[model samples]
Target: MGVGVFGRNHARVYQELERQGEAVRLVGVVDSDLDRADAVAREFGCRAFGSIEQMLTTHSEVRAASVAAPTVHHLEVARALMQKGVDVLIEKPLAASLAEADELVQLAATHKRIAQAGHLERFNPAVRATIPLLTQPMFFEVHRLSVFTPRSLDVDVVLDLMIHDLDIVLSFANSPVKEVRAVGLPILSGKVDIANVRLEFESGCVANFTASRVSTERVRKLRFFQPQQYVSVDYGRQEVLVFTVGGDGATSGAPTVNPQIKVAKPTVTSEEPLHAELKSFLQAVRQRSTPVVPLEDGRRSLALALDIVAAIREHGKKVGLAGLAKAKS
Candidate 1:
């Protein structure tokens, strides 16, 4: 795997897995910035390429790629790799638009190679713990707020931060979104840095989500309520709080006892999900099995994200937010 854009982190993760006798190796590092390239390559004892073309031309053993390039460059770079028979695990949001995502998905299908999305939350232990519990969610609520970070300004909060929640919500419901409503404004940044969205799903599940890159504190959580219980999960803290009826007569109608709250600390192991995700992709390639987060899933998330962005724009117009600054003000 070639570390693209500060992708030495990918190299580190893979090397750590290799140290554990896992099936991953550090092939090389690639960067348009020669200095960054040389620095990371020297540290990893691997070759460095200033361009994807050079990497493809020079390294024949490079079978797969983890695309950590910027969003705008994702489609172009990943498509080229796919054309060359290299599977790609692209960073989240897939691409800037649904159209681009579609193209990449088709290319992967055409080539019969892997095209996985880096929605690392799919592998998150917190999410994995909650997946089985979310059988029939009546209502879902998510909050993903962080003290303003300098990363991911190429797009707004919807695409940058909120899409993670959106993807998770969609995955749980496994239903089509019926309607979307959103409000966003550029605060602290010259783009839509913060936003709130509501999504209506056909399965009678409604989701309210709020995301902001401008905040004093950080929080990543999701809450879901059903007929029998309410679940509050702190994804940031890896904590789950389940309030539900207990005892044999619990489901006998008369609300048996207080809601049982279980705090299941999942044996804090050093199993990084991103590393697991990357390993899964590699294993899929080696086994010719399906990737956990396939390209189609990424496409669906991108499509919904674009709809939310459009809804926010419409909200802007409704409130007479004709200018970006006015919306923020």
Candidate 2:
């Protein structure tokens, strides 16, 4: 409902869908700030409202809406929408706390509303192609870094950035986390700006993740090793590369770099992830089915992110960072 950075993208995609002949319409834009709402609505050629109630009242034809408010307000906004029979796509990190996440999950169920979580990476073409190739991922190494921006400083690097990789790794691992070890520092923001985490899963899978918002360059890539093969995914490029070990039995599919190694790249139908995500959400809404990324999935990812944050805090305390942050603040 809010027309901030990410919210504007949602509105843009909806408007694009209308122009592309999709059975969808961008009814209106809503924000607590009336001026911002009016600006975005004027840009999109739609009406503007100062609150969800106003938008819902003015645009009764809106069957679905995106809850793009900040994390703390997710439950409040989504709950209001679901209660009024409007399906919602809530932005990631689901909520500021697990209790709030659980409440939204229950509320969605209670209202029988089609609720989805905005885990945009799940819609990436590379990730979609790699899903079927998964056999048994043993280890993962992921890096997501970006130059510092004032936006989303409400959350640490783990929630703001690494949660995308966390959701992917969790899906691939398909097991509960057994242990978490993490370390992070506040370089540019009060929240952790750079973090490194190691997660051990019950299935004996290990994942190491590094996320930074204070970087000189931008990077978004993930590489994982499994039995007899290794797979690499480039989120920015929307590509997947598979390196397989060849046995003496066969080698007819891909080019062989050596007698025992074959490298293959899966064909990726490149599309903007956010566009694909919103399209998928609409499809789910029309079909009355579960979305590719559901509320439970968001909650699971949030749980892991919160645990990693807790680990970071505990580690920081052991090293006197708690006092350091307090003193600085």
Please give the lDDT score at residue 275 for candidate 1. Answer: 79
Error of 1 at 135 (Å): 1.8
Each candidate structure's count of clashing pairs:
0, 0
Please give, for residues 3-93, the per-residue lDDT of candidate 2 as tens digits. 8999999999999988999889898999998999999998998999998898888888789999998888998999889999999999998
Across residues 31-112, which tens digit of lDDT does each residue of candidate 1 receive?
A: 7787777888787677778888888788877888888888888898888888899888888888988788989889999998
Q: Which runs in model 1 stand beyond 4 Å of their true positions?
A: 1-6, 247-270, 325-329
Q: Tell me the whole-model lDDT of each prediction, alpha carbons only.
A: 0.81, 0.91
Record all residue pairs in model 1 with backbone atoms less than 3 Å apart, i.e. clashing.
Answer: none
Poorly placed runs, candidate 2 (over 4 Å): 249-258, 322-329
Per the 3 Å backbone cut-off, how many clashing residue pairs does candidate 1 have?
0
